[model samples]
Target: MEFKGKLSLWQRIVRAFESFDSWTAFSLNESGRRFGAAYARYAEAMDLFQVRGAKRVGVEILGEGLTLGVGGLLVMLALALPAFREVGGDDWLKKQDLAVTFLDRYGNEVGRRGIRHDDSVSLDEFPDHFLKAVLATEDRRFYEHFGIDVIGTMRAIAVNARASGVVQGGSSLTQQLAKNLFLSNERSLERKIKEAFLALWLEFHLTKSQILKLYLDRAYMGGGSFGAQAAAEFYFGKSIKDVSLSEAAMLAGLFKAPTKYAPHNNLPAARARAADVLSNMVDAGFLTEGQVYAARRNPATPVDRKRETSPDFYLDWAFNELKHLSDDGKLGGDRVLTVRTALDVSIQKQAETAVESMLRQYGDSYDAKQAATVVMDPDGGVRAMVGGRDYGASQFNRATDALRQPGSSFKPFVYTTALLTGKFKPTTIVTDAPLCIGDWCPNNYGRSYSGSMPLATALAKSINTIPVRLSIAIGDGNPKIGRARIIDICRLMGLTTPLVDTVSLPIGAAEVTVLDMTASYAVFANGGKKADPFAAVEVRNSRGDVIYRRDRDLPAPKQIINANVIADMNGMLVKVVEEGTGKKAAIPGVRVAGKTGTTNAYRDAWFVGFTGNLVAGVWFGNDDYQSTNKMTGGSLPAMTWHEMMAPAHQSVELKPIPGVPTTPGGKDAVASASGPKGFEVAASPQRPAVLNPRALDAIGGIDSMMKSIVTRRGPSAFLEPAAETNLFGAARSVGGRMALQ
Candidate 1:
């Protein structure tokens, strides 16, 4: 076993060193060193042995030399075959169509974004000190090397051997560029060989300027800037021609670690790296000592606040829309698919501007915090989305991904559920006092409530106990009835996360995402239909063939609530803006209706409302979930909603939620801009009658009758009948009998 191990090791070394036929390979072999002249003479002697071994091949003295050479060459070729095949894509690489989104200047969706990516330009246009800095530091011999530098390779090999590590980096800029653009991130002998072959080929086939241009175009700069031009814009908020040397150096130094040295991240680390680049420039003669000193002393100016991006929100909505199209479920496929999203530059600009204003005003205490916004055409087309303050800072996508307490905004769902299913209505009355499920107690934002307010009044004021009491009064005994009890309602509205059904869930406990809640509101906005909110309207391939069209009928908005109840709910929501907590969301001319939610921890604030034409949701919170600035939904989010919605309603009139029309895009679409001029509610076609509020409340906040049927806490686990009876028995015993009795 020991001898076999040694033999295997010797075989590997022999194959490695004797493989290539070049003198470079022969010089590396130890045994071949001793055989120098004899090895050459052995070739001549092979002719005499060849005749004797003609009948049957014989192992002659000369054959030994040829055998060794041939066997090693074959081994090397075997190892190199796969690498030599291609670096990145040969025929296969051409198949992939990258997923890139293009937005208008105001960051609104102009149309479908991204393609095969076939663009390159000149070196001078690719400004910023970084490229020059990279050229200086990485390869001074780049201009001189004819692709594969024999001397550089030799030096690298010597250093590698001495260091007992892969320390040598002799590949010229051409080689490195080839590896990056064409090769995988692999370090192997085979990779090195391929790099050499490709580099030489590139040198012969492409000009030096072409090579540099390609390198600059393909370079990855941090902060989502893909190329040098992009890097310059990201760092300086200006064109490449406008970048200074220090700024250029900062970007150039990022070739090592884009995220770590990104100007927005660690200014100190970025500066130190820039100094290193300046030093390298001095050594490379790109700059003199005086220039270097000047650059070092001059600090890079602050990169201007970039026009904000909304990749997270757009991607989220795209993914949401993708589910309808992707039967198999994957994106960024090889197909040249085009997605037509319903993003309006006008509304998106308003949403972002509002979010930015809030962040600028209140972000000091909410440092590193983020906010998200979503606006939908009552039909569920997501016209605008601002996921966070900075999409590049972190791609966590709080708008769509985050699941935080909806504060009081979730009350409408529970209230709406009661209105639609059986016996619940806005006119129902319930006390806003201490409420409990087993040992758990829930409270309002101020721990105060009106004694016996009507349901509409409670919701408008965002009083906590009304929704809880209403949820129990109607949904009691049926798990499907309570808001906290049923997550499928949330699911029906496009909510993907689990709604934790805790005791306080009636008051927006546990957590739900802004999207999930906003989508729920869409049901109310569109006359009780729950159209799945979507960013992509229609998707076409590069050839303009429709590949994926949003199925307006499939994930169709089922009648989740009654039209009359919806009308009543909207009437109350309007009061929320007109006379309640959402005052800041009130638009001057636009008749807006919505709800406000502020979590117990004050960690999240939300305002969701709708005009005649649109329904928008805005949320404000620290990305880390820490609370400061003491912001409430009524403050920042409502104000943002007001700011955005006010302008969005310009040139358009605010009408009631349009009724479902027969066609997808028809008069109903236009009708959304204004109310029916002369339509009489009594004469117009309408749905089921709202439940008698007095009769439903005969049970008094369904606390006892149905406590067992619904999920006990948040929106998760189901409650047993036995548990419900126990809970019900206590609440019923208050007056010597259950409230229902």
Candidate 2:
């Protein structure tokens, strides 16, 4: 057996050796060795020849040229990356998705925004002088070169270097069109690279006349006008086809800096710019000196329109709302729409006038630099919006864009939440003492609290601690849970601004916009219905087909708040205007309900209220968040609200607030012993004992009366007394027994 095992192992080894020899036979042959040697010799000869050849030609000529050529191509591709990313598909050339024209509530054309593709006028219709003037002034080499004119660019650089400033622009007309169509006005290296590449793309795909036509049709020509056709009608009150030589020159001059040389705003500067255009025309050999002399001598004059004031802020917000509707597919993908908005131009003018006059009269005294107001119907149709003192100075719409602390005005939401719990009422007794939640103690506005009062009086007085205690009490001792409840209620009431969850949120630490606050209050004004503010009433396409209608397309306002809860909240709010901090906002005959909010350090003052017909909110503060000079919600904001609203109700039949009692003549009914239970009915000491209804009919009657009272007693006049005075002349002091009427 041992012999057989050794023999088997030897046999296995022999077999393995045989297989290895078979596998190696081809590579080990003489032919394989000869081929390998020949390849080695060939590689050595080629290496030697390459080294010699490289040395014979200079390194600069052979190596650097190829390297630089590759590097230049790579650099060009890198710079053109943005252009490639911008034009991902064929639809890139379609600049505007929707062209819109805005009409007011009365069907009067207010303004036009967005680019109307159908309004494009062909280059064939443009007069020779108009075309020549545009080319000579904007781009002298529009037809002579490609997208980028190297000669014109060099000339512009030389001229700018000689002048030590940018006296001329180097961008060709196609480059300008590229920027206008696809890029923003941001000045940066990346944007310029994108602009240059896009210009080349446009030139390659479009004819010169097409590029020029797009440029004329898309450029912003100031005064809210976009394109030459709109500019001609706005400045000359004529069509582009009918404009004379001088008028065409003036219009061409606006392409450089429209706002700086708008004829209606500054005629002398516009004329000076037009004269420069005429000189360019003469220099470009497009016209003779004598031919241009006529234009320079006569000088174009834009039509007089100084008295017209465009509702730019309102139009901006409406346009934004329309865009949202289009994005939601509610407008049926219509590229061109004529929007009929709910803007009442008269009320808009009134709102603007009130803001301007208040700033002019008291802005300096109060150290306030900006103010904003929003007016809407109880149904949530925005009628008037004043974004700022001047829309021309700033396009930022404070009424909708600015998120400000609503101060005590936010307390109503807390109160509404508390009332919705069914455990709290307007007259529920609550202690108003110093409150501390995990060492974050809050105090009353005066830092002194009334020991105990009705829930209605606490809100009317704008006490800070009561809301904090209520926030905790309603949440089963969890303030955070209570705050969440309040936020939920605010959202249901039509406020869209994000509310912060914090201990101080009960006292208006959360930021909100004026438009939202006003619309939320419209819930109470319209009897607990949802009042999500809307601007567009109807939208029609370019073919006059109805695309969207508010009544047909949108769901009717739902009852978001319980009717009983709304009534309870409205009662308390009415008490505020009648005898609490919002007394300055009260109209003699109309029953007004609202709340006053003053933030810490007086940085923000807000008074949002509503009558039967109109709901308005007013905010006064510095744009930089600077504190005013002891301004409170009751002082200027309430006064401004009263100023705008008192006149608004004169022509319309007064409506009634949902839960407030009113007499037949539209005056709030005198509270009696039979008034609603669990609500305080009181007379403010600051109010005149007897107000003459006839006196309210005169101009500035309410203003003079309110001003005299406020001026005499100062801001303290609106402060709640430590003891409440019932309508029957009975006094119920804090921490004391209630006195029945």
lDDT of 2 by residue, 344-373 (tens): 776777678768777887788899989999
> Model 1 over residues 147-241: C-alpha lDDT tens digits?
77677778888999999997657778788777766676687876877787778767877899888877665656666556677677657776666
Candidate lDDT scores, in order, read: 0.67, 0.82
Error of 1 at 267 (Å): 18
TM-score of each: 0.56, 0.80
Which stretches of candidate 1 lie above 4 Å from their native place?
A: 1-91, 95-116, 119-339, 362-369, 390-396, 474-484, 544-546, 551-557, 658-741
lDDT of 2: 0.82
Q: Give the Cα-based TM-score of candidate 1 against the true structure.
A: 0.56
Q: Clashes in candidate 2: how many?
A: 1
Off by over 4 Å in 2: 1-40, 43-67, 97-99, 112-120, 332-336, 357-365, 664-741
